[model samples]
Target: MKTLLRTLLIPALALITLGAIYFLSAFLGMIIPVGPEKEEYPKEVEIFVHTNGLHADFVLPTTHEVHDWKDVLEGKHFGEFETPYLSIGWGEKNFYLNTPTMADLTAPTLVKALFLPSTSAMHVDYMYGKPREGDHASSIWISEQMYLELVDYILGTFELEDGKAILIDHDGYYDYDQFYRAKGKYHAFWTCNNWTNRGLKKIGLRNSLWTPMDWGVFYYLEK
Candidate 1:
């Protein structure tokens, strides 16, 4: 019994230590600016970053002067209602499909997500109006050129076929939203928040050094 206890103790302590290190790193990364200071552009376009306590989504106006999302995402998927904005997010396929709410989450789903190179999907939520302040959302003003470049970066993250998004047939929990196949594998290190961070970095926004949680993305924005 003592021998068995000794064997179990080492692995248990190792896991606890690792957990502490991960959380510490995430906290410090949020407070520290990893990249250069955010740049300001002469011309500004409003974009939103939203969080649902756990995940982050980028919200952009549907029709920008440079690119109209309707050119790609049609009104049909959004119940034929021409929304003014779209909220987009990316996550593990299994988590996205199986766990629309916290109640739907399970240990197996989390285990597979953290341990395996899982498939990914993108979530699209159409909105009739712009996101308001105090909506747990942060708004950034970027130049039209930067916004256009960010648009290209975003669309590129979708796994497209013949210049079209690969639609995933699963129904979203909300009526105004849908899912599509996405590029990259979702794992413990490279998470949905990390994807958002990278997207912000691509557009020369202030972002965390390394973050796996939603708060990390918002921390820099709030500051």
Candidate 2:
């Protein structure tokens, strides 16, 4: 009986030792280099551009005033207008950001509209003097020339469709029924909100992360 027990224990101990050796071998394989491989690093894509080519780090705020697109067009101080703004809250309803045609916008802060005047330095075919594609949610205007340049720049700088940028030309002012239709594209829509959101995220901001900031209110005329 003692001999039978010794034989069983001996076999079990040998099996366990072999299993431990196999596990260590696999672990060591992960740490030791056995073949040629390339090291990778995080990639960053630039979204905003200053005339002088200085990039303002796109940082998001914890809370901000919601924009009234019509009021902004009517010359209201829609927060900071010189640099674009971005937000991440999902909207429950559609909001107005631009009109189909050009109209005289009159508001107390009407002077702010000078930055995006239609008949001055830049022809305002759409609000901000940009071309409008006939969608309320896509309330953006850019020089047909600038738009093309931006498209090329975005495509060349990053792997857009899936990598860095998505198209923002669908449904309401927030996520809505038509939102997905604008997916897998770039730079058709132009809102300060959209621009800043894309800018911050492109610079490595995840949806739920809180980052440090310095807040200031500055007013400048648009050229």
Candidate 3:
């Protein structure tokens, strides 16, 4: 009995210690800024960064002067709806489809997601209008050039074949929301929030050096 108990305690303690170190590293990475974002450009286009306390999502107007997302994604998948904005979020495929609520997340599934690099998917949600400034949401004004850069980056993330993104047909929470196959692997270092962070960085937005949580992306924007 003593031997078995000792064996269990060692690994349990190790896991706890590792978890603490990871969280500490993430906290530090989030606080450190890459550099000041380009403020010289006129803030003409409005883009939004949204979080649900756990995940970060990018919200943009469905049609911009330079690009139209409806041209890329099949409008029919989102059903017939008159929406001015669309929300996009990328994350692990299994986790995204299986774990709608945190309560549904299982230990084995989480371990696989964090340790093993796996398939990724993008969630596209049609929005009726722009979100107001409030908890879990914030807006950023950027130039047309920067917005185009961001748009290109987003389009590249899609797994295109025959010049179109493949949709993952599945039963989900809303008729207005759907998932599509994406071009990246999901892992601990490259989290969903990191995808949003990298997109901001690519568009010359002030962002964290590295972040694993949604709050990191919001830290600079909130301030």
Judged by TM-score, which candidate is best? 3
TM-score of 3: 0.95
Where does candidate 2 stray beyond 4 Å? Answer: 34-223
Overall lDDT per candidate, in order of appearance? 0.85, 0.26, 0.88
Stretches off by above 4 angstroms in model 1 are 36-38
Judging by lDDT, tell me the better candidate of 2 and 3.
Answer: 3
Can you give the lDDT of residue 8 in candidate 3?
Answer: 100
TM-score of 1: 0.92
* Candidate 3 residue lDDT tens string, 45-140: 999998867789999999888888877888574457678898899999998898888989999889878999999999888889898878889999
Please give the distance, in angstroms, between residue 161's alpha carbon in candidate 1 and its true position after superposition. Answer: 2.0
Candidate 3: the clashing residue pairs are none
lDDT of 2 by residue, 1-223 (tens): 9999999999999978976764465344323322123223332222222210111122121122322222212111233243233212211111113211235234422333212322111000112222221211123232333333434432342223433333234333222111111112221122222333343233232221111111100001011
Return the candidate ranking by lDDT, descending: 3, 1, 2
- Clash pairs (backbone) in predicted model 1: none
Better of 2 and 3 by TM-score: 3
What digit string (tens of lDDT, one per residue) describes model 1 on residues 87-157?
Answer: 99999999998898999999999989987989999988988887776647998888888898888988988
Rank order (by TM-score, best first):
3, 1, 2
User: Native-vs-model 1 lDDT?
Assistant: 0.85
Q: What clash count goes with each model? A: 0, 5, 0
Better of 1 and 3 by lDDT: 3
